[model samples]
Target: MCPPNCLHAVCEKATRRGLLKSGFTLGIAAMAGAGSLAGGARPASAATDTGPLSFSKITDMSHTLYEGFPTFSGERWFEMERPVTWEKDRVNLNRWTLMEHTGTHIDAPLHFSEDGNSVDLIPVADLLCPLAIIDIRAKAAADADAYLTPDDIAAWEAQHGEIPEGACVAMNSGWAAHLKTEKYTGLDAEGKNHTPGFHHEAARFLIEERSVRGIAVDTLSLDRGLASGEFPVHYDWLGSGRWGVECIASMDEIAPSGAYVFVGAPKVAGGSGGPSRIVALH
Candidate 1:
């Protein structure tokens, strides 16, 4: 069920008190135990033996994929079975199969545009960039179909300064907290799925005006759930040679801006989309 003052969807106003009082902020510390996806590789300052490079906390923004996690209806869900066990084969081995876009994943340009680059073609440098988060969860809680508009982007900018060119933008709906509920997929009485996403104008503004490198969301698709068959967000971003990340988890842990994210996904030949392991450093 939705929280008090939130109807079938979430509420439009979220206060720090409300977020804490509702227990939405609990257990989040568990997501921040790791640091530095770059691993043992240190910056040049430390390489010179002057001193150790300053370290930052790492927060994993990817969801753990497992057998039978919720998937878009009609799409293949993940499945795994143990092929070998310690008692039988002297080792533990398991095999799993899933669609490319399943769970936390990236949608390469080829996923939507015929002329766009495939997963293997996306440059390594483009996958990592400045992170800017646009929080519209409060508004989305009031209307499941709500999307970010130009004004919304401006509002975020007013507080965080301009969203830099080539930066990665994240649309944090606070919906990840609802992943265990039916509200994650948001099926209404009439069987329509209503969820938050990027409005067409907002998408265009981000891509054409702001020159953003990519966008991520906490929902199933960058387009709203009720977009029916039209994927405006995908067409706008991927069509323009930009990439997108979907089903990103734990975005609420990061600040609205000034963070860096690394999008690491297997490079599948001729693939349109693939599973990704995304992380943020703050």
Candidate 2:
């Protein structure tokens, strides 16, 4: 048993281990910016090193999972069944059925690359990093198929300083508010979708130039809803051995540049994608 005075530390240790079992790492929530928490939380060798930041509130950046939630074309929706209700079995056990890519989730490299790492194999450092929020909501509102260009990223960097190498760059398309409506998907008469996403140039710049950990978006897919032919964005990014986070929620609540994002997903051995709980601490 932990000593009374060691309760806090013990709890933190337990929490960290539990997260690892769940396919997450407390390092994602604890450490931010361009650093890595690969092996585990900071070692005892660096216990006293408080490089930057002190205290802050953690914000939930994921969506609520429920039956009939939105889904991409040809993907299964979410479902929940309480097979063992408390009244019947003196316990409450739930059985869930949903697509790996449903709701807010991380698209591991395997989603696009034939021999890439699966969700469980993605390094902890990649899921946890400083967030670069590019606000192009106004442009998206005017044009449903708006693309976040390199110029937009440059403008954001001009104000927030250069995006740190290995950070997670997220597109703030202001689409979360419309999730309850058909407009969130923005399907057109020809059955084509019109959603905002990063331009090919922007993705290339973030990957090749910035050396970012990955890209994220608050929409159905990382690529625009109306992307024609092959998913060039996915092919370009994930195919390059990186990952993607999609359907992120609550971008408006966090700061544009300083927050740290934590992505928690199930450790499905070879899952190409999976349901995730993403959050940010500012």
**C-alpha TM-score for every candidate:** 0.79, 0.82
Model 1 sits at a Cα RMSD from the real structure of 11.9
Off by over 4 Å in 1: 1-55, 74-76
Question: Each candidate: what lDDT?
Answer: 0.74, 0.76
The true-versus-predicted C-alpha distance at residue 195 of model 2, in Å, is 0.6
In model 2, the number of clashes is 0
Please write out the lDDT profile of model 1 over residues 1-282, one tens digit for every residue.
444457313423433336423423212222222211121211111112222212244578998877766665735578888889989998877888888888889998889887787888876756766689999988998988888788989999999898865568889988788777888888767677888988889888876566576889998888989438788888877887778998999887898886767799779899998889998866
Those runs of model 2 whose alpha carbons end farther than 4 Å from true positions after fitting are 1-53, 74-76, 226-229
Assess the local accuracy of residue 225 in candidate 1 as a C-alpha lDDT between 0 and 100: 91
TM-score of 1: 0.79
Candidate 1, pairs of clashing residues: 10-141, 12-138
Residue 50 shift from truth in candidate 1, angstroms = 20
After superposition on all C-alphas, the RMSD of every candidate to the true structure, in Å, is 11.9, 7.4
lDDT of 2: 0.76
Best by TM-score: 2
